[model samples]
Target: MDKSQLLERVIELVVDITGEDEVGEELDIDLFEEEILDSMAAIELLLAIEDAFGVSIAPTELEREEMNTINKIVARIAERL
Candidate 1:
């Protein structure tokens, strides 16, 4: 998928995991800071991303800050793609 579509899918995964519709409501919001994402949720998102896009992100590959926003997550996945 293209970058835009990839980003949408990532947002969907985050919303599904967090049950936070606000995730898409604010494209660059800090998920962890908002308590929308924690360690486990981040892991879940990584797995979903791997399933959806075949991009595997080891936890060690990026710090939480690097993946705290939807835009950042999409950018990380795009780099692997």
Candidate 2:
């Protein structure tokens, strides 16, 4: 899928799992700092992303620096794809 589509799906999954409608700011914004993503949320997001993209995300891939924002997450997934 395209970046925009992937991002939207991520946001939808995140919202569904977190029970929050607003995701806040832009894709570049740090989800942790925005309090929109925590450890639990991250796990849920990772699962959703994996299922959506049909790619497995290794646990070692959840680097804090690499996955701090939605844009980065999408980029990583795109690279894997």
Candidate 3:
């Protein structure tokens, strides 16, 4: 998928994990700093991303700082794709 599509899907997954529709409004916000994603939610997000994008993401393979925002997540997925 293209970047916009990837970003939208990532945002959707984040919304599902955080149960916060408002999160979609701020694509650049830090999920961890905002308390929208903790460790457990991050793992769940990784799994969801794998299922959605057909890309395997090992938790240990990525730094939280690299995947802490919707934009960052989209960038990472784009790289894998």
Query: TM-scores, in order shown?
Result: 0.95, 0.81, 0.95
Q: What is the lDDT of residue 8 in candidate 2?
A: 82
* lDDT value, residue 44 of candidate 2: 79
Candidate 3 on 1-81: residue-level lDDT in tens? 777888888888999988989888998899899999999999999899889999899999999999888899899999999
Cα deviation at 19, candidate 3, in Å, is 0.2
- Cα lDDT of model 1 by residue, 36-61, tens digit: 99999989988999899999989888
Tell me the number of clashing residue pairs for each predicted model.
0, 0, 0
Error of 1 at 73 (Å): 0.2
lDDT, candidate 2, 1-81, per-residue tens: 777887787777767877767663476878888787888888877888788888788767668779878678878888899
lDDT of each: 0.89, 0.78, 0.90
Record all residue pairs in model 1 with backbone atoms less than 3 Å apart, i.e. clashing. Answer: none
**lDDT top scorer:** 3
Please give the distance, in angstroms, between residue 14's alpha carbon in candidate 2 and its true position after superposition.
1.8
Off by over 4 Å in 2: none
Considering lDDT, which of the candidate structures 1 and 2 is the better prediction for this target? 1
